[model samples]
Target: MSTLQIGVLFGVVTFIALFSGMPIAFAVGGVALTFMLIYMPAETVGLVAETLYSELDNFVLLTIPLFVLMGAAIGKSRAGGDLYASLNRWMGRIPGGLGVANVMACSVFAAMCGSSPATCSAIGSSGIPEMRKRGYSPALAAGIIAAGGTLGILIPPSLTLILYGVVTEQSIGKLFMAGVGPGLLLTALFAVWVVIRFRQEKARVLAGDESGATREILREEGFTWREKFETLPRLAPFIGVIVIIMVALYGGWATPSEVAGIGAFFSLLMVIVIYKCWRWPDLKAILGGTVRESTMVMMIIATSFLYTYVMSYLHITQEVAQWLVALPLGKWGFFVAANILLVVLGFFLPPVAIILMVTPIILPALKAHGIDLVWFGVIMTILMEMGLIHPPVGLNLFVINSIAPDIKLRDIIWGTMPFIGLMVFAIFLLAVFPEIAMWLPQNVK
Candidate 1:
């Protein structure tokens, strides 16, 4: 078969496997193997081995496990709960105060934990219950947590940024720096939406005098500043971990991999010594969980390698790149088209899968058009953030809903609309003013 025909077949097989509920790693691996066995030489097996080894052997990939372990340890240690409680007490008096706190807490946690589900699981566990007790509708609570969860990808230390840097050979440190401003911008937008919603609710309640008497609320469950300060110390270890990693990376003292190792070590130490949250038995369980999660991610990476190999071998990526570049659109047109395509693909594939599959093809076209890669990475990360909240298969929606089963899927979907609009606004800002993502990376060090 012609290489083009082989590429077409590979694409079809990959789509089928993805929608059929098969694991992404296996899907990519299986499709690649089929093509390699049928069309390539039998000795091509060596190439697969080489691809797996080379991809996994990277120093940067170590950061993934370290970041994952840090996130898991913090989650299990209940530091995140403390952080949220602290914020809640301080912000709770404001209309939708708890909701605003939820977004703020998630943004803080996202800086430390780069995974979306981990962010959702950690914050949703505490934020949802607190908001529910405060009389916030489960839908509103779930929606806020779900949307806030997506900050995981846009914020610093983002695994998605790491993967994008690794795949595209961009500077991971620069990518992390580039994300800082945009991440904060999105978080601020979410906060504004919360405040607006809260004000509307408060106005309606006062208009009807539906609010309970102040003494009644005080007697029932008054706000407590005392608990807020008491909970502040519990966040120290997490803060320490983040500071160490960021300092190490930004100070040129350590590579991302080395910093990840340091971060993981400190995280383990914090859980065992500082928090006293994990004993010997709990340590074993945590390790087991980390292994399981790491293995799943690694498997996906391995399979994606196979898929990338086959696509390259068939020249599909090259053909697509050439085709895209030949189009009449200029740099801006290509940027818009790429964003739209990624948003569409994100609905079906995980961010890793989308990045791995499309970037190899689109990046060449982007560079040929004189686009800034760091800027593109930030834009893509924001688009992927949107994907996590989008319908049909948004990972964040499922995560929050899983924690708050009382929330209907429709409610979670509807809540994200405003946040999604904000994200689109951020994307436009980045596109029109590339410096939003580029300025820091350029000026820093």
Candidate 2:
């Protein structure tokens, strides 16, 4: 009967609806309406319409579709192959070179695409086959792609960070800037893990272990300087896109929305011009996919506003915050518990849904503890990044498996475990230093 009890009951119902095969937008919106009609005054029904309209009216949200469109165009084009070709020419001679190149390519592609599955699909389609050809195990190849792909949500221009910014009322640009350090940190960790795996496998191969026996130890010949230079042109379009977006954003030349539009246009233009692989069918498919994906994100955003509305009216955030703050757990103890809960949730939920659903409930507590929203955005994005590589619901694992069907899902999951550990290590670094994520955002003009 009390507001808090009703709010808690509504949350339970919403989750049940989600697990029972209802769409997230529908589940959240339907539960919210059901509860509002029962508990809120009839005169307050207008709040639902107002909340829906205002949420969709946001100018920043336009970036979501544009970024999705840009990613679709790039992913549909030859950029992935070009990226792998160029990087492989340089890195292929190193131990586990193709895997290293895969991580690098994913990081670069993440900057351009701003999506996990897109990065996984685009890179894995090319990288997995190449690594397999070089005698890399299918599991290691698929795992690298799956884990590397998660950078899409943590790198600059990330949709996850954008949504987090919108939900927490933080600056989107600052969140993007904050993501760069952590993104690169994860990339380094993954790359290092690849090298360590390479060494271990090499030692096993020398010991006559069957599993590692067929693995290639080195490239037959290093590329000539001329050969290396020849491959560099393939990456020009990708590099140009990254430079334009970064300079436009950090140099104060444009807003995030404006840059997203520019990036989308340039991505399409590159596919048609530089790649010269454009076709009417591909364009149609890209647009169709963009429409579907963007619509899903928009619907969630629109409905989440209603959920936020109900919570606000009921003062649920305040009550929860009071409870959390009253706990005997200190700041560190509270964060440890929160991180564990998020990691568990990461196994079951999509990143966008997690942000929309959990953020409102947790923001008040985080704010009460003086946790900086921008810093927490980076931390939360990393955890969500892990979710994309986590098994069962780790969407990127499925994406990679779909691209490289010969590799078993469990093998891919196994390969991802080490990277998952690296991600956790990155989180630990963020927790201890804080400034790793905060320094840039705070120092930026």
Candidate 3:
């Protein structure tokens, strides 16, 4: 059989494994191993071992555990709750203030945690109950947290960006930087939608949009100017960590790995000293959680790298890319089609698998079209975010589902529909004005 046929077979086998409920790491690595034994000499087994070592040996991977530690520390300390409370008190009276606060909290936590589910759980646990108590619709309240959590991928210190960089061999720092503009854009768009929805809901309640339904309300009391000022200090630890990491990463004071170390130490310090939140037992739990999460991500990455190597050995990826480039779809058509494919695939596959499996094939076509990879990474990340909110397989939807079990899956899907549209709009915005994602990493120091 031709090499291209082997590559197609590899994809078919891998997809079947994934669909059969096999773990992504095992499925990918297993398929690669099966292909290698059949098509290559036994001596080539060493190639898999070498690829695994080289993929994990890099300094950038160190950022994963440390940043995860920082997130775990903050999560254990309940800073995420305090951060939301403070923002809630301040924004509660505004239209859709609680929802707005949820998005803001997710963005801030996304900066710290770099994990979507963590952000969803940390913020949703607090935000959902509060919003529910305030008479917000279950669908609306759950949707905001579900969709907003996706910012975890687009914000700095994003695990998704880190993995994308590792898989594609792009600079991790620049990819992080590129994510900032698009992240902020999506956040603003979400906030706007929330406020607008809040107004509509408010008007409907006042006008009796739902017969006998209680009016959704903003808390008009319990928080004064003085109280708002007093709550500001609760946020200092989280804000300080952000400032330190941002300065270190973009100010050229440190590499991403070094910044991760600094962030983790300070996060631990905050949990113990400022918040006085954790005991020795809590600290041990945090460490264990960090190890578990980091190990899971690293395993997928290592095995996927091995899988990627096998594809290269068979020259499958290049052939796929060449086939894509040969299509008569032209540049814009190809871009649109790729986005559509990713959105559909995202409904079934998680972001990590999509990145590892799909990126190599599309890269050559992208290069042929003269697309800038840094810019494209940001675009692809947005699509991945869309996938996170897509139903049936969007990891974030399930995260929200687990946190707020009262919310029906259908309602959650309905709630996220508008946010998904905003994400698509975000992609279009970036495509037309590539500078939204490119300007920072290109010009920022």
What would the TM-scores of all predictions be?
0.93, 0.95, 0.96
Superior candidate under lDDT, 1 versus 3: 3
Best by lDDT: 3
C-alpha lDDT (0 to 100) for residue 181 of candidate 2: 89
- Return the clash pairs for model 1, or none: none
Instruction: List residue ranges in candidate 2 displaced over 4 A.
Output: 212-221
- Better structure of 1 and 3 per TM-score: 3
Q: Name model 1 segments beyond 4 Å from true.
A: 1-3, 206-228
Q: What is the C-alpha lDDT of each candidate?
A: 0.81, 0.86, 0.87
Writing each residue's lDDT as its tens digit, candidate 3 over 1-445 gives: 9986787688789889999998888988898889889988899987778878888998889999999998898876678899999888888677778889899999999999888888898999999998888777888988899998999988989888887887778988899999999999999999999999877777777666764556555433246898888888998778899999999999988988999999999999888987775677888988999999898888888888888788888889888888899999988999999989888899889988889788877988988998788888888889999999887888888888898998899988999999999999999999899989999899987
In model 3, pairs of residues that clash are: none
For model 3, the stretches where C-alpha displacement exceeds 4 angstroms are 211-222
True-vs-predicted CA distance for residue 411, candidate 2, Å: 1.2
